[model samples]
Target: MAAVSKYLTAKNSAAAGGILLVLYFLKQRRRSAALNRKKGSANDLNSEKDGKKERAAVDKLFFVRISRIIGIMVPRLLCKETWYLFLIAVMLVTRTYCDVWMIQNGTMIESAIIGRSTKGFKKYLFNFITAMPVIALVNNFLKLGLNELKLCFRVRLTKHLYDEYLNLKKIITGHYVDHLHNFIFFRFSMGMVDSIIAKYFATVVGYLVVSRPFLDLSHPRHLSSSHAELLEDYYQSGRMLLRMSQALGRIVLAGREMTRLSGFTARITELMRVLKELNSGKYERTMVSHSEKDVSEKLTLVPGSGRIINVDHIIKFDHTPLATPNGDVLIRDMCFEVKSGTNVLVCGPNGCGKSSLFRVLGELWPLFGGSLTKPERGKLFYVPQRPYMTLGSLRDQVIYPDTHEDQKKKGISDQVLKEYLDNVQLGHILEREGSWDVVQDWMDVLSGGEKQRMAMARLFYHKPQFAILDECTSAVSVDVEDYIYSHCRKVGITLFTVSHRKSLWKHHEFYLHMDGRGNYEFKPITTETVEFGS
Candidate 1:
């Protein structure tokens, strides 16, 4: 009887120890949870402060910038991008529903296994397997839709930028001024803000509340199920909460991504602003003045006082002030004129407004103050020392700035093009390069002399009224240059030759000489008047 009583006491002691251990563990868990909550609150406060600072640094007109970018991405409401975005939304909703269903299905399966119900387990397992394929399809399609949407956005933005960049007329018209103004005045209504908030509110609240109910699973009577069933429910609830947290984490990550996107948006918008300013013929230059009094003229726009008149068969410049783009006066006042069939040789010392004169004539540089007259566009062609070689076939070299279709429209055949090449002594290239359709990197492939001759061939093909040969034959031999000059005379193409070569004086009727100073002289090129060295 004493041995039996001792065994009972030992058993009671073990039971008491087990109870104390359980109570200690429960207290420790509560303490850990409290510490975690405190850390989380501190982190939340820090994150909120950081987010506000980042937002302030991003842009004051952040929404306007976003709206403009969105406008560029989706010019039309019923576009392909819109369709893809809709599909992505649908997929996200479907995925969320599938997640919920999966959680419930898993709970059923777990309950079946705990109860040792073989039929129920098999039924739930089959359901899980069947649903997997559908889930996989949804996931892949979602990825595809997202990628396509990205591509569409990229294409749209690129095309928009190219349009603004490439269209010279649009840039010159100052259209971007209005666009910038519109962006500044862009209104972000309260209703729209409310709508955006409303869209995400449900998702955020749902995620936050998802784990709340599962946390208090101490009472099995709250659920109309057995203890095993309650355990399965609790397990599934935990898994669902984990998934919800992951989704919430992605949302938070997206906020960081948006912060990065704001940087890119700011850069793009700044670039657009600069381009618009340039398009409107406005430029900013930091002028370093020689004297302190001239500091007020640090930046100035070119005065729009120049007029260009397009008249056939005559070129003239009246009181034109030749200036560089930096607002430096190259020539204060200049007057010149040449009628049809009058070939003038332009000669000047370095930086003496020689090229600047032609730049004004070509409308490339803004005319500061002048009344200039020139032949209509396409009637005047300038061939530089280094001619441009386009990317295309051998035939394209001769008829540059004109396509094969344009050549055909002008009733010029490959045979005629060959004749032009032959005139420039480049006809052999056809045989060497295979055929007219053979394409190569012409700039790298052709020699410098060949490129000049090719430009001459292009000149012959177009047969302009006046051609500015700016040392275009420097690379070619004297004989080839003579042939090219004779051919120009034969074709009745007047030439404004800029050269120091004495042999070219015979081909020109007039000489325009500019000293390194602002002074210049325009005179008839005669035997007695022609100065050999000077």
Candidate 2:
């Protein structure tokens, strides 16, 4: 009858498990269907497809990314603070030993109780009591130390990445700025805050609630006839419960650590990818002058490539075709150049290659199928329609890409910075913001025209030989625009400006007009050639 009852119980358990499996399968199917619906929806299908492609790419590079991340961390671990890591290792070993010792002493106590050896029971109990507090103290101390070490490591990693970001000499695009936030999030996760909290918090709670109950279950009973059996059964039950709780705690902690680690890895890998892009010279644009020698040499534009071709009287483009980064040709076999001191006005309808032409000149875009000449990087400057407001004092904005020390060496002073601001009619900002040294969020505090005027102030401060002002004065009044151009001309800053304003032609000597259909015209802008569509 007992065997029959056991078989019935086993069958019931099996049936329950089968029902659970079916439910789990249905749940998973529903989840997959929901994901498919999101992926197939009209509004999000294209974005979902792109996300899938990105995911696939990430999967392909996951192992390489992991290796790179490890490569970054391992060196720090083995640095001068290597002793700290060894101490952490020793602490972990001590923790494991304490756990094993506790289990062994626990079994000994149970045996002593069952054998009715009062002396043995007392000795084992005293040993357990002595070791428990010491072990707990050591464990907590080690955890605190570990967290501090992790924090130090995170700081070092963040500083290294910041140095890399600063070393990149390119314009800070909006896309790069967005990724900068993601990179900071990655840095914060590097501390493994979740794992630390889980370990300490769960351990304390497990000891308070779990250990107290186990102790209650294992408490000594009155000495009686059934004392040995009763004590033995209770001891065994308490040991099983304690071990089960510890195992479950470890599993939960491991799951949380793994989840945080996965997130940290993804964010770090993406940040590294962006850093690589920022450091690369030719990402979207093809350099017509890139040769084995030039690649091996410095990253500057080659003299023949597009910086200085004075012998030809103008920087020539030999059958050059301009294309978008995606390889769609915008202007084919186009050729033009402005010599030193010759100001050119780039006029075209919206969506034409006027701005793109400046991009090519700025070396921010690739010049395809043509060799062009441009001055060395520092000799040229670009002021976009929406100027970049760097994070610093008003002086920093004007003399950006140049440190205060560099400017000092170049004989620039606070007085000079203030003068440049006055040149752009922004000298009032000095008083409004307190002084040139008073730092503020200039982008937010300054209006649109004020920002452009600040950019012009920067231009006047740098005094580059050639400046590409792409509708930079669109926000300023006509009078202000005239003043800004007059300042540039007075400072001998040759202009390659893209503007629809007819009032700007008087400041330029030549015009390069595009029709947005791979057609362009380049000629002297004289009295008869100043009208639109001319």
Candidate 3:
């Protein structure tokens, strides 16, 4: 009668498991369908970018998709490491099981070790040896899989962080403005935030480790009644420690989040201050005091790079009491000329405002105490020190600031594109589909030299009449640097470059030097000769 009841129970358990298997398969199929649909829709980006606003929208959507994957994968992966520490626990369980069974007769050593002498000891040793390989193999396999999975997850997470940094870097590089202070603050604050979260995660894992032993009991009253009661209390203390750890981790996370929030709040306040001064017209009276001169009518033209640069004076701000005597002339005057066939090299030591002058010319930042003429806008393109890479394809980065029609009109052929990459040496990366769109794990794919070379490739594609190469080739090797300068010189791009290299000096026909005391000198390169000291 009992055997019949046991057979029925076994059949019921098997049927329940079969139902679960069917449901799991159905769920997996649904997920695959959703992913395929998204991937299919993602393929038509080029056709959809018909308008300016639509293109911008598509660009944003492209970034959001990459970011969404990163966001989902990160927290899940970080939490998964705690499972590794759990493997140690399974060992203790096996040991406890052996200890319990051995105690069923007398104390383990009394009968098993002493009564039968060598025979009993051999049996025990053989048992351990027989089970040892199985235990070690299981543990080793589990650890190997976990390590490989962790490594893969870690690589993916690192890639995501780089993606986030690159995206934010683009916005930070607006107008080529110097935002060194802002960058420091941003990285420092975010770093603290990341640290806090990771520490909290570790704390949570520690708590689980301390408490899991208490919760894993098969029977509560196995020992002598008093002994069992004492053991329960002893293990229950582990749970209390876990609860305390959880509380501490939560508190730390909350505090760290508040600190980051404050940093953002301070940025808003600074922007508001700038706005209020502008709205209040704080500089209007000062700007008008210069005899009410017509800055526009004082236009001058030095035709170079297919455009005219009209400005009376360029200066370096002294930022000292003597330079600003009436608290008026904060900067000194500089004059220069440019002809159609010359490259203008702006050279100075670090922080001498070489980059700032480019921004003034680019019309990104306002020029102090001077009037600049309006040139045809599309003829100019500014390349900064660090090339800004976005979350898109190589095609997108290459054709920036130009429309699809413009690209076609400019005659960008496959051969041209491939040749340009080959010149800069980034051809292999672009060969892979979605290589540019592929989220990068590290900027190391291109070395400093490679990045600079790649930037030059973009320069080749754009073929802008005027190119501002502002330390844009610093990371490039000296050989590649000379090659780029040689090419630009040959092409007659009318370059305005800032470099510390003497090798590069020969390529330019004009020069400018700024001393930080608000003093500057501008000269035609034809009249100057610089010799290294003997």
Best by TM-score: 2
Q: How does each model score on lDDT?
A: 0.75, 0.68, 0.53
lDDT at residue 308 of model 3 (Cα atoms): 31
Candidate 1 vs candidate 3: which has greater TM-score? Answer: 1
Which ten-residue region of model 1 has the weakest summed lDDT?
1-10
Better of 2 and 3 by TM-score: 2
Query: Which candidate has the top score in lDDT?
Result: 1
Candidate numbers, best lDDT first, in rank order: 1, 2, 3
Q: Which stretches of candidate 3 lie over 4 Å from their true place?
A: 1-267, 279-330, 374-378, 401-411, 428-442, 531-534
**C-alpha positional error of residue 357 in candidate 2 after TM-score superposition, expressed in Å:** 2.5
Candidates sorted by TM-score, descending order?
A: 2, 1, 3
lDDT of 1 by residue, 372-457 (tens): 88887679999999999998988888899999999999999888988988998988898788789999999999999999999999
Q: Per-residue lDDT for 106 in model 2? A: 85
What is the Cα-based TM-score of model 1?
A: 0.56
Question: What are the per-residue Cα lDDT tens digits for candidate 2 across 120-190?
Answer: 99999999989989899879878876886787668766876776655553316998989999989966774
